[model samples]
Target: MKRRTKIVVLGSALLLTAGAASAATASEAPSPRGAAVSEAPRPHEAAAPETDRPREAAALTGTAKLHRSAGDDITFSFDAHLAAKDKADPMKATGTFAFSHYQNGDGARAEVAVDCLLTGGKVAVVSGIVTESDLPGVEGKRVGVTVHDLGRHDRLGYSWAATGTPAEMDGLPKCVSSAPFEKVAKGTGDFTVVPWQPEF
Candidate 1:
């Protein structure tokens, strides 16, 4: 009877030890569904809000005029009043140019290059060529000018083209010899221009 009692007590103790070991193993194992829940953000944490910003302005608008001196040595005078699209400051420039006149199959051609400085130390360099038709009429008298901007090496620059009819002038150098030419011309038309590209 005494030995049977001791064996029963030992068996009960072993059963309790097995139950504790099984519980520890279950606690250490990870649950498949709950794994992702641990990585989710807490309710109080939030993402930053975005804010609005202003964009940079581009392009300038204004009027310009070009004068051609009639003689064997043809010369050009250029002037313009420019207003920046982004700012209220007004800019003015005056430049002198040397041109070559030639007779093309279609008509007369004039090519010019100019370099000038603005009031505030800004530089303006222009290169252009113009053509006049040989036909008789408004079309024949019409002059087409193509202007290009030689941008500053460090920053972008601007350019424009304008054309007008000849008018009488009071003060100008006399033609070396009597020739058929207009004395003065005012800007009456403008061509759409694209903004100069920035230089890296």
Candidate 2:
């Protein structure tokens, strides 16, 4: 069954790769009780025309954990090292990414809203131009900007930027491929993500 899930997922990814050309929409993946995974933007924010500050999506409200095993040789634990498993922001100037296959993200949604180029965990000042990639196949490709934390640091969060802000930040660089992720999920399973893995 596990292998089959892999096969199914990989097949879907390939199809989605080409299908993404005109995919136009995203699907909603349900989560445990309070948190719900979403492929589309909220009615209000989605309604807004442009991407602005790093606002938490109402669709995004919950706790998360990213970890590695004690016996493992890897460095960070799920809480300290989670992959930005899936990312999409209508805020993105180009394309929308649908996140699937998230593994240990218990009780929280696996996506967030950030300027395609901007990637900051918390922001001190909005002075520099943080760069980031944009959602593809759209009006703007991936410009650069900065992601400012909502000022509430007790709860962890992320912001997007098109350019790089040289401020003091804790968020790891976005790992679009084989690098270690920084979110937590529900399990003892090791999270090994590649550019092609569905998520989870």
Candidate 3:
């Protein structure tokens, strides 16, 4: 009976030791399947890099010259030199103006178009409408002219509206040449140019 008692006590101690070890192992192990998970970042919540920010439009000021063709169906070809109002870069422009009379005899309208080459090897095509008042007078009067881009695939787009005067050279009753002429008028204006976002 003493021997049986000794065996029983030994068995109880062994069982308790096993139970404590099992409890410790379970506490150290990872959690079961259904615990909460951390969320991934959303697109809107992320911050944009500094280089990805959009560029602001630039203000520009410059000069222009128009050599006009005489007679009823007149043609005015022009060249413009422009500098950014706040920057050191310059732009060059060359284009033509063709006039058409209104059927109602009110006045005349001119279709104007020009190719503007900017400093950084970019090209923009500008076009707009003009009136007789926009032309340089024989007395060298300043006139207002406005033009916008023709949707060319340029990063920088341009639109300008400014006043300028003409400087006519002494000659005969003639029309403006298709090429640059000696007897040309001078013009100047101010406007803004904007840049488009870059494609990835």
Candidate 4:
């Protein structure tokens, strides 16, 4: 009986040891559905190329005269530059904008200090505060302007054109304006614009 008991004890010890070893092995093994691991680039394959993106620096300098009718016309000039590193007024600009409108034989002109400028492709939107004006109620008011350089077919638009509503004249924000949809007069002037993608 004593020898039988001894054999049973020995067999149980070996089985427990084997079970513990098996559990450890299972724990250390990687699962087939585990998280993916990134592989190193192949020797013959070139590294992936980065996407092309536009820089934040841009410049726009142009002048144009647009005719509205036989005796009405609008002329403007812009010398604006943008190098945005943050969101602030003037958009880091050192530029000026001048506009003139002639109706029959009467004329009015306004000069502005640039506040903001945004450009993309051949289009640019500019906003400024009127520093001097011959037009009534325009001085000290914010105004918006837009321009499009289409080679010989440049266009321009203004927020204060056509006597806008009180909200439009008083509540216009920086860097906001309408599209440049008005056509430039043939042989009147030309516009040159350089645009860049703005980081929003």
Give the higher-TM-score candidate: 1 or 4.
4
- lDDT at residue 95 of model 1 (Cα atoms): 21
Worst 10 residues of 2 by lDDT: 6-15
Off by over 4 Å in 1: 1-72, 86-122, 127-200
lDDT of each: 0.23, 0.23, 0.26, 0.63
TM-score of each: 0.18, 0.17, 0.21, 0.64
What TM-score would you give candidate 3 relative to the actual structure? Answer: 0.21
Global lDDT of model 3: 0.26
Give lDDT tens digits, candidate 2, residues 1-200: 23322110110011022223553566655666875553566688664444654332211111223232422111111111112323343222222221212223211111122232223333111111222212222122211112122322112212222121112233433322111223233342232211211213
TM-score of 1: 0.18
Q: Write the per-residue lDDT of candidate 4 for residues 1-200, one digit (tens) a residue.
A: 23211110100001011123342333345545756874555867743444434334666676767766554556677877775453233377657777766555565677778888877788888887877765566678887788888888888766755444212368788878776867888875566666665445
Model 3 residue 108 CA deviation (Å) reads 2.4
lDDT of 3 at 8: 9
Steric clash pairs (candidate 1): none
| Candidate whose TM-score is highest | 4
